[model samples]
Structure formats: C-alpha cells, structure tokens
Target chain A: MEKKRNMQSKELICTACPIGCRLTVFQDEKSENWFRVEGNSCKRGINYAIAEMTDPRRILTSTVKVTNSHYKRLPVRTREAIPKHLIFSCMNEINRIEVITPVRMGDILIDNIASSGIPLIASRNLE
Target chain B: MLNYELVVIGGGPAGLAAAIEARKNGVQNILVLERDLELGGILQQCIHNGFGLHIFKEELTGPEYAQRFINELLEMDIEYKTDTMVLDISEIKTITAVNKQDGLIQISANAIILAMGCRERTRGAIRIPGTRPAGVFTAGTAQRFINIEGYMVGRRIVILGSGDIGLIMARRLTLEGAKVLAVAELMPYSSGLTRNIVQCLHDYDIPLLLSHTVTDIRGKDRVTGVTISKVDQNLKPIPGSEKEYQCDTLLLSVGLIPENELSLQANIKLDPRTGGPIVNESMETSVEGIFACGNVVHVHDLVDYVTEEAQKAGAGAADYIFEEITEKIPAVPIVPQEGVNYIIPQNIRIDNLNGFLDLMLRVTSVYRNAKICVRADEKTIKEVKRPHLSPGEMERVRLNSNIMKTIRPKTISLYIDGEKTQYAI
Candidate 1:
C-alpha cells in the first residue's frame, strides 16, 4: 500500500509555553541525522523537538513498600530522567526492595536501577 | 485555658511557614495544631516533582519541599501538636481544639493564623448524572491511594477534569499499567500548568478532550463506561455530540474550595470572590488579631506563593504582638473591573504598608496583548503590559510605596486596557 512507504513524521506540542505550539518533525532526505522541524515559535521548541526525536527521557516517580514504619508506602524517584524503555524493568527491581523506617529524603535506595545508571532515591522521610 | 502568644491552625506549608516566621520575629509561646497524624499535610501524598522551583531554585518533589521546612522547624524547637483538630475559634482568640492525647483543650492566644488549606471538589458537588459507584474517586483521593497507600485504583479510567491533580494522576495511572481513556475538561482550556500538560499527558500519548463533559455514566456498582459530549459556549452539553467510552474508573478533578469552617465560626468577614476571609495588605482579617493565608485565604496555583503569602500573615501577627503596627489604618478596596476575575488583599491599608505590597489576581478569560491598568482618583496610576492572560494562571502586580504615595483615592481599581489579541497557538 502507498501508506507503507510514507515517510514517518511525528507531531509534538512544545512544553516551553502555555501556548503549547504543535510541531511537526521530518527526517531530512539528505542525512539520517538531519531533521526538519516546523511550527516552533522559539529556540526552546526547536531544542525540545530535536531532543524528542533523538533521546526522550522522563522523570520516574513511584512508591515502594516500607517496613516497620508509620506509613505503609515510601515515595521514591530517579535522581534524574532514566531511559524510557527501562521504566518497567526498573519498577521490577524497585518492587523487590523494602525500605526500612527512619529513611531520610534523598537516601539512595537503589544505585543505577535497572542498569540505567540513575539512582532511585527516597523523596520523603519515613520516620 | 492554656495561653500562648500565637496559635496556628493546620501544620501544613502555610501554618509551618507562618509559625517559623513568627518565631523568628520574636513571638514566643507559639503552638501549631494539626488534625492529621503527620505534620506535612497533603504534601505527603503528592509524590510528583516540579515543586520548590521558585523557593529552592531547584525542582523538588512535594514531600521534599515539605521536608525542607520540616527540617527547619525541627531545629527551631517550635511547639506543634499532631492529630489535634481545632473545633472553633472565638472572636477573643479562644481556640477550642480536641486531641486524643490531650483530650478536650482550650487555648487562648494573642494572635491566630488560619491556614487550613483546601479540599477537593467531589462528584457530589458537580452532581454527575450517574449511580453511586465504587469507582468514583476524587483525583486527590486517588493520588493519596496510589502514592501513599501504594494501591492501584483501577485498570481503566476516564478522568473528568484537567486540573493539575487530574493531569498528574493520568500519567501516574498510565505508568502503573492503567489505560486512561481521556482527560475530559469542561472548559476549553486546561486549568493546569502548561508543563503538566506536556509532561503528564503529551508524553504519555493520552488525549485531552477540551470543551467536553461527561453526560452520563453507564455502570451500577462499578464504572463500566462513560458518555462524553462536546459542551456549548454556555458549558451545556450538546445533545447530538455524545460519544461513549468503555472504562472501569471515573476520576473527578473538578476544582477546590478553601476550607473555612472555622473562619465562619469566628465570624471573620469573607470575600465572596475568594471564598476566604477578607484581608488587608498586612494579611490581617477583619477581626484585629486574626490572620489568614494560603488556601485559607485564597486558592493558589503554586505552593511557593502559599509560603510567601503565609510569611506575610506570620509577619502581620508578629507586628500585632510586638506593637510594631501602632494603628489600624482604614483600608482602600481594590476593585476588579473588566477582564479581571478577582484580586487578593481585597482591601489595602496604604498607610500601614511598608516597602511594597503584592496584588495578585486572575483574569476572567483568555486575553492577548492586554494591558493591566491600576486606576485611582479617576487617573491611571500604574500599568503593565501582558502578552497573554488566562483564568488558570494568576498574575501578580507589585504596588510600590511611591505609587501608593501618588494615589490618595479612597479606592483603587484594576482592569484591562488596550485591544484584545488572538491567542497565538
């Protein structure tokens, strides 16, 4: 079908402003690394478009089981954005761990979780 | 009755910040009473980052933001009682509170700060046309369940409002393996921050349905489906534009109302617009010694603003106690005119003000290339040009002493000037 040969393009909304300008991205025919970004109003949008096309990352936030604490769950997060594909695998390793009571904020619970080299740290104190 | 210099109700961000500031201002014998078992209040359940961007100058999670203040309060040796519910506050600063450990207790204070924060609007408030089901939950309640209790609400969901809580929850649920059908918003535009829309929904490939409302729910015991319809300009559902989606959970992120039950009992004059106590530049309520801030004063979009506003109330209480405020000046009302929804500090005590005062307000609707004007004595005093304005985002204008000195009018009015421009996006 003609649809199968259609060049792949993606639409993204610029996160820089509340205006949220919709952007369209196309891979340049000349080079695989070159991208033609359209519909961005500012430099931040162009940067967002390029990064999204290349390496997209998201901050992972979730809760882990807590033992012998006032609360049953302790909130945890990656110190920085981890590779998007490793989120579920990271959750697998995170679920196996049980944090003890008297944990302070920024306490690294797991070092390089799921081989992403990003530390999963406690976001709150469980005293 | 136990007597103290100051008694702060609610040990959340506002109360804690107020208590700490008051302590630093030489006001001793302060007690912070909190109804929750923990001191941080709702911040404990909000596990998302993006808080403290303005205060700490770095992005921190909700709990991390509260912990920073909690750590500071700990070193100060400030007196606080958790699991203590304040029942009533009398005109004479008599606080009637009860706690399991202390039983029935009455505390008389020289000054009091009300920072009870706010509560989420539930399905009952909006009267969604549906049978009472097990799956209906407020976005905040669901957030507390998932983030605090580590319990997944449902496998499939249809969120009713695009509030920040709802938007954040959409991503949270999606990441946890639940399918979010769509985030239906009654308003045409999102009430949440722009970053939330991009990160929470756009990143997750979740659809945001604007100018849409849930017309019907088709489940008896548990939510099985929801019928959504495009809304008219009046916000009424269009009859023929209904579309149905199959989902198991229904989350409501409608809105929030400032918790002011004690304010009512104390007979503090409330501004009908803010749904909180009427306050002046000093954050002092009509009742001389009573002060209010944070959501107890008006709903704020950012916790950073809450901390800043509460510090004003804290300093106001300290000024009242330390005799720094010699006279209570007659206040000049700041009236909201065209394009302006409402403004905080409903009244301004120009004579009592030192340095500058912040006049925070929101617009009634979206505007572009609009100029916000402040007028007094039938003359324009101060004007600031804004590229765009929306109801979701609050705009703040600073009123310096020099401007106040120029205006001797009994009332200062704020309104929009210039032509309305189209939204670029």
Candidate 2:
C-alpha cells in the first residue's frame, strides 16, 4: 500500500549574479517547512529561488528628465529592489518628475517611489 | 610641441584607470585625450546597474563606476583634455590631435597607452534584406537616445540578437510603456550573460526565439513589421518556419569590434582572433613604448576586468618610460590548441615575469565537465577543471613562478578536454 502525496515544483534561473544557476523549488505538503530549493551553486541562489517562488522583486533603473544640465536626462535607480509588479507604476511616477542641475550622484530624486518605500537616486552627477 | 611622460588616448574607463595607475607608479605629467565632450565615453549612456561587482564588491550602475575612476583621476590632478580627438600616432610616440580649444596640437610622449575601446556592429554588417527604413537602430544607439538624449525611439519594438545590450534595451523600452514583441537570436544559445536572459527577457514575458533571425524588414519610411525565420543547423533559415512580428522598431545587437584605427596608423600588430592588438605579458604592443588595453586590446565582458587590464597597461607604460623592463631573452610564443579560440599576451618574455602570470582565454564552444590543460613542452604545467565552459564567458588561469623553472624554452600551449555540447536555450 502507498500513500498519496501532494507535491508542487517550479523551475527557475537564479539572477543573483552573472553565473545564473538553475534552481528547482519543491513544495512538500506534509513537511513543516513546505519548500526546498535544489540545484543552487551557492547560498544566495537558495534565497533567490524562494523569493522568486513567493514575491519577486527587481531593481528598477531608468532615466528622469533633467533641467539646466548639458544632458537632457539623468539616469536614476531605486535605492533597493522593489516589488516586480511595481516597475511600470514606478516608471510612471518617475516620468512625471524633472530634476534640476547640480544634482550629485546618489542624490535622492524621489522619496518612497510609487509607495514602495525605495527612494530613486541619481546614478551620476549632472553638473 | 608639448611633451608629457605618458599620453593616454580615449579617456574612458581604460584610459582613466591607466592614467591613474601610471601616476601612482611615479610617472608624472600624464595626459588623457578624449574625443567626447565628457570623460566617461560609452558608459554615460549605460544607466543600468550590475557593474563593479568584482572590483567594488557591490553592484553599481555604469556611470557610477566610471565616476569613481574619474573622481580618482581628478583627485590625482592628472591633466586631461575632453573633446580632443587623436588624429594620428607616430611610431616615435608623437600624438597629433585636434579640438575646439586646441586645434591641431602635437604632443611628444615618452610612452603612449591606447584605450580607444570598441563600437557596435551595424545592420549593414549583418546584411538584413530590406528596404531602407528609418525605424531600425543599433541597440547601443537606441540606448543612447533613450537614456541620454531623453527621446523615445518607438512604441513597439522587436530586438534581434540576445547580446547583453539587446537584452537590456528590451527591458528599458518595455519599462517606458513600449511593447517588446520578441528577441530573436540566430545562435541557439545567447551570447549574453545568463542572468541577463532571466531578468531582461523571462521576467518581462518577452519571448526569446532561439535559432531565429530577421529575414526581412518591412517598411518604406518607417518599419511597420519584420519577418523572422528559424535557422537550421547550418545557420541557414528554414524554408517554412517563418513568423511575422508587426513592430515599428527593429534593434540590432549583433556584435562589437575593437576600434584600432590609430593602432593601424602606428603599424601595431593585430590578432585576427581577438580583433585587437597583439600584446605581451606587460600589455605592451609590438611598437615599443606603446601599450594597449581594455576594449581596444580586446572586448571585455566586465568593466572590472577592463580596469584591471588597464592598470597593467599603465604600469607597463610607466616601466617603459623609466626603462625598467629589461629583456633578458627573446620572447616565447603562446599557442592556442583545440577547443581554445584565443589567448591574450600572445608572447611573453619569461625572464621579465613576476611571481605569477595570468592568462585570459575563451573556449571555441560550450563544454561540459571540461579540463583546461596548460602545457610547457610535453609536461603539464597546470590543469583546471570547469564544470561548464561557454564562449560567452571568458576564463582566466594563473601560472606561478615555480612552474616557470620546468619550462624547456619551447612554445606553451593551452587546450580544453571535455564533452563538447551544443548550447540550447
């Protein structure tokens, strides 16, 4: 006699670094932890796989309009990774703002962008 | 004619780092000549992160990484001229350049470093059969327009080739409310980093069509659509496997070529395999007192590696200026054997080597469970086991001075032994 088991699996490619590791996430219904990650080359991939299976996030980078600078746009990025689903909405908010010149690199252009609590900072100095 | 101890051409990451290193090595009066209005070169338009991981131990955007070098260079008080283009370089180290501020200026330098970097391959280079259209743009050009110029290229996009630039643009355009239909790569496996494939394409649900290429571009004044076809084993398009994607923009990211026009003017030797200058262990070119590094020597995958190589070139230039590199014997040749595409520092003067030597190479194809064997005569000097090897990623192996004592003064060879695998996406 055999017992029936509830098992779910998902395949993912870890994007923690350039050496993208293929990861397999398995969910065991009977286990207390429920999720187990396999095929990771390092410990970082384990967290990446689990986060991917749960709530995915990404560091959103884009350009914001600038004034009084030699260049027309200033490159900006989120201070931290935000929820993946908020990328477009973040962009929409970023596009609405125009920065002034003499903005230093790492200057906060937008605070709590898109209500994600991640500030958008300038990627370069615009003199 | 103005004179300097060292003259670095192209004030990008390579030139900046090289100049800084030379100054640090006690060689003063260094000057960097840049053709652009600013110092950062192509990095100014690369607004994305994932740079400086190895060097800084933290991820940074491209401009931020370049700025760190630029700030250091400025702090060192190294003189540099922006918007100055070097027109020619004589074998005797005379640099002729022109700029708005200093028109037709000539500088006599004791040592010169070439760091002119590379340029992207255009549509004509790949020869896509199509009528002349306005919507086609190279991936780098599109990146510059969108990121720097603050202009939208198109609302609908179809990118060809899976190189990192192409992959990044697919995400960039999509974030700006553009529809990225597909990314078609002629090769079965992407030539880009694996992380880029996952983040730029998979995350966005943009289909990456492997072994596929754009056969035709359809539009008169603007690109209305494109026809993509699956390629066969021979890399030829299959007869019946054709799909049409109606996109207004077609972005090409085929490849990048080293910018070595000035190297040719100076009659420096170039390697056809790497499409860059043939350098020694010291990063010195065939022309004495002339050193080259970074993308001008060979296209590098990482900016951190570029900085490291440029520092070597800078140190080499300083040593040449001070006459510190004493050649005790004729240089020995390095040979690339089966499964190896090419090796940098094509020749080395073993007597001038320090405690160790680092050799960088790329495999001819993808391999599984591979062993990279370095041989001096018949004996194996060093062997490293790699679980996986791909042409997309460069490999580096270090040789210690202890291994140099066993050499027979013959040619050194490097090759891979493993099960060759055709990379499939």
Off by over 4 Å in 2: A1-7, A16-19, A41-44, B405-408
For model 2, the docking class works out as: acceptable
Candidate 2 chain A weakest ten by summed lDDT: A1-10
Q: Local error of candidate 1 at B12, Å?
A: 1.1
Q: How is the predicted docking of candidate 1 categorized under the CAPRI scheme?
A: acceptable
Candidate 2 per-residue lDDT over residues A53-105, each given as its tens digit: 77888888999998888899999999999999899899999999999899889
lDDT accuracy of residue B47 in candidate 2: 89
Q: Which ten residues in a row have the lowest lDDT in candidate 1 chain A?
A: A1-10
Evaluated on CA atoms against the true complex, candidate 2 attains a DockQ of 0.48
For residues B248-316, write the lDDT of model 2, one tens digit per residue.
999999999999999999999999999999999889999988999999988888889899999999988
